[model samples]
Target: MTMINPAGIPHGYNTPIPSEILTADRVETRIGTLEFTDGFPSDDTAAKVFDHLDFLRAVEVFLQCVPAASMEGLRAGLLDIGCDAAHKMVIADRLLDSNPLFLTGNTDTVYALAMLDLHRDGPTVVQIPPGCGPGTVNDAWFRFVTDMGAPGPDRGAGGNYLIVPPEYEGEIPDGYFVSHSPSYTNLLALRGFVVEGKTDVAKAMFEDGVKIYPLSAADARPEMEFSSFSGKEFNTIHANDRTFYNEMADVIRREPIDVIDPETRGLLASIGIRKDRAFAPDEQMCGTLADAAAVGNATARSIVFQTRDKRAYFYEDRKWKTGFVGGDYRWLDGDGRDGRNMDARTMFFYQATLNTPAMALEMVGVGSQYALTERDASGAFLQGSHSYRLTLPSGVPAKDFWSVIVYDPQTRSELQTGQPLPSRSSENNRTELVYNDDGSIDLTFSPEPPSEHRGNWIQTVPSKSWYAILRLYGPLKPWFDKTWKPHDIERI
Candidate 1:
């Protein structure tokens, strides 16, 4: 049998499979199309295939959003659709082979690592071929067989080693101990390692000291004869880990740090990293804190919203007044217009409004619901507004606070104005808000503030549309299971 190169094929299939060699009858039973002979595909198989497609689709979608052509080679082979389970797996394997990390594990690990990077604040070092630049390692990229383990301690969790990128040949300086923080996971340091000519050299700092481990076999492996050494093992921490913040100080102490390239810098800024400073938490890190709030005035709009799932919902009035909602979402549009431009800002507002309550409720035990308010919809006073409101009819679970935030429809960024963007249940804003004597909440939205409830009001910008997101901390069960419905916005 001749070896068939998967990557050599345009979409991983050969034409006719050399029909002359097999009888027609035998050919039908032997190597026919995979789609015809299957029972229902299992969820696991579907998820695996979906992950592969998601990566390809994400890169394609991101390229579509950005104006650069750096990814032309990867894009050329992604046009064909997989026909069956085997075909999908084959195609996925080929794609995975192109990236070193995925060749060793499932895509979830890749996604998890990406999420860690997004949420953690720090510089992430990724291992790559000697000449490859930082652009090649993106949100979808992962590493395998690293000296460190994955970000946290679940599947092969060990230290900051796995999360940070490996040093390139001639990159490691001398006398550096490759230490990392538990929080950001990306900010790393190499102390006490010696920088020799074209190579990093080091002697055991202590009788039992740290040693370097090779991820691939091509590198030199340490033998007992080399040296007996030991040191403190690295630890992986979650976003909420208290040690994370303290570690930030240590990360900043390292000198002559390897800065990420400008392109990656721009990408980082796009994701909410402040361009003004070298070290600061990005947007994802803000979401992890209970009291943390995102920067209110940042002009960086979500340029694109990309997701693996294809299903999404959009509601619009006759005038094209629109609202959209979806999960695992990514930005596709940036212009904010309703047509085909794929507005990331609009989608971000809709998604935040839709998911925040659900997420908050999950943290508590409540169920909540959301709906777009129509011009003449009628219900209790809580149900009359054009703005969105989530209520913990049973009450919130937090010992301290909870609130709702509003966003501009076009930019998906927080609407900046004199009126407060979030309405909290705390005494500071509660007495000024419209609420039932029974303690249930109502959020008001309009061009002008309501006559009675001024504090709980969200102002709409002129010629601009808006969407509201409700965040309920320590929620009740009714909010999560969808048993409780959210009040709508009424344009008075």
Candidate 2:
């Protein structure tokens, strides 16, 4: 007996099994009736199926590109605030005011942010104030352009910076530090530190030192307009819904065709988002795009909150964590192979906007440091309704200032409670904060301010859940050496 396949191919030197015989008979019968076609099985239907699959592949690519798109939306939102490219916004009052449109906002330092529209303007000039710490100029795609402040090219002494747009080959002027941007739009964000929490003085320094204008109108440039976004409510985060695709499409139309890689542009082209062309997707395509956006948004959120990387945690026994999982600014995994680290890119852009080498640089005396924690000391998610306390040991490591800011888990922005910015700081302005005899500071987080130490408490909303970040401006050696550590948020 022999075993045979459906095609009647015999299995050597054996009696044919019943199952094999049935399979061979079925295959033989099917083959006898089989009809061969030159192309698709049905009239053009197979081609349509392939086309649909290609569309899905394009969607996945677009999903991976969400961070770039998100950066563009943020640029647009910033521009919308001032409604003018020449004008920029700055925080005026020392008091932390209303919610900022930007995500993972810090109530620690005074900020002066501007959205530059260089698509039609050609080039823009920005002047930074001397003594300002680390700040960044990021393109619309959130890619780092350059650094400003002490660790930056200016070396803590502020100077004029010329930001030339993409493909600009005009006259190269001398006397100004130059940085060429890859996108038509860029975010020029600066942080001003107040000594001993004198916010008014810091705000004044920024007002007098900072200026922005196009190179063409250098002499006749309008005075830099300063608007106070503090103590006011506004949104700066880009929508993560289907409209996010539209934002990306807008970026495509405005930016140079070569700004992004040809591969990504081709993916957008496949979905009818070519430069200068109307991106009017048909009903069927729109439905697919919406579904893709939903999945992309969810994927980004999961990456930020429930990160798979164990490296996100800093201590083995404690729950203290870092937002940058891999620890490297570039998010490289020791082996720098792939393009940019996509997971790191997604996590940063999803929560915050700026990018710079200074962010990862362990500057001993001058620069910023950050620690983020989502879970309590017991490895449980933080809830606003529950009271928690964190203790910062004396010699807090921040030479300039330090702050603890609570944020909404969903928005990743400042947690909006009765207080515009739910934070406590060690600045001189926060003179009310009480410290222990040993010099350690205790911080309380709860829906209601703690009974005895109201000044040491940060308020949280009752029904909402939140996370918090500890920002150290002008970080010191103890921070880098890990000699000084902050206790985890302990539920009380």
Candidate 3:
């Protein structure tokens, strides 16, 4: 049959138009059917597509802005603990244990942390104590600002460092390592290594030598007060629900306009989360946002627990995976040839905190290295009900030390059990670990007591799932060269 157009040209006098270029009267998709009239979508179809588009943007927003939301959550947690000012520091005086809900925090180092607001204080001065381990400053979006101690310009001798805001054009002062940050709020974190399996020396070093104050009051700085958050029950993990969007929105409002790129700004704006306007979504939008959050959370969890990317694995046959995929701190693919590695960024930020170049491209025998595994040798999720054993080869390949920590799959924080620390460290020993005859170490995990190697057993809660991370402080050449491999956790 021939169809007549409004223009009245005789059947368009041309070859038959391909149906691909035209909208059909009815089309079916994952979101049901869409109806159209002469290439124009029906009202119902338009509504469906609009709702679906919002859902997609929200999910992507959750993935891309996790770094920002996580940072905000940390800030709020610290504020609740009275570490509100730069002068007030939260120090893990007894070493970080399972009590505090910190993301992937190990039980190996004494941590001293302070939150800095560049907006309130134009520039801040941080005095790192000598013998400080890895110290980092991350900006509002969790981007690296600077390193202060061992991996920093100070080279472990400790030095005074100045951190300035993005727009600060103040007079540059000499005799201090200075770095400018693009965001208003920054996280100042310093780790103090345990000296000979005790935290007293590291705690004293941080309490007596470390100082932080606004650059304006260089003459007279406020007295630094340390609060021990070691055994405290606190939460720093971001929400996986719709409340996550609010956290991101708060960060956007507090930070500068250019803190995020235009594309990201537009994405957030589409979801009624702009920096300038109130994020008051309508009832319908609210429901959509909730659904989006659930799906986004599931997607992120999948990326962390069962990543499909081959690059995430450390070896061809090993389940040990590096969280910092692509070995680029910036998440650039193909060395920036292919844009950002979205999966890599989502994987790292979802499970960890404190992003810096040292996390990725550290030299051998310098920075730390980590390998995470949630699966057994048979490729099943690590279940708390079952018993498992992980054996490390004789030469563990850590110049400074090595440790393994268990974490709750739900919170991505330390797993809480009868043990307070939930880890076995070679140097920062919370408990003794029995070594094999050939110097190999066998670590056990189970809900019940293991018959032997009780000292090496890290308890797991029944009916709960968990994962483990192997940390190598001062990683040596064997680690980088892949000569020393970790055995997969085998079900016993």
- Best-fitting candidate, scored by TM-score: 3
- Backbone N/Cα/C clashes per model: 49, 11, 0
Q: 1 or 2: which has the higher lDDT?
A: 2
Model 3, span 343-438: residue lDDT tens: 899999999999878879967888799999999999999999999999999899999999999999999999989989898888865357889999
Worst 10 residues of 2 by lDDT: 22-31
Q: What are the per-residue Cα lDDT tens digits for candidate 2 across 1-492? A: 234576655565244444422322111232132222422144344455555665575456555666677677666666656646655555535544545656787777777777788876678888888987567888867778888888788998898888999889899799888999999888777887666656777788778888888889888988777877776555667777767778878888888887888888887787788898998888877777777777777878787777786777666776766766566676676657644567766777788767777767777777778888888988789998899999999899988788888888788888888876688888743677999999998898989877797889889888988988888887899987888889988999
- For all predictions, the C-alpha RMSD in Å is 22.9, 5.7, 2.3
TM-score of each: 0.33, 0.87, 0.96
| Model 2, global lDDT | 0.76
Q: Which stretches of candidate 3 lie over 4 Å from their true place?
A: 1-18
Ranking by TM-score: 3, 2, 1
Candidate 1 CA-lDDT value: 0.29
Span of 10 residues, lowest total lDDT, candidate 1: 103-112
Superposed Cα deviation of residue 154, candidate 2 (Å) = 1.1
The numbered model that scores best in lDDT is 3
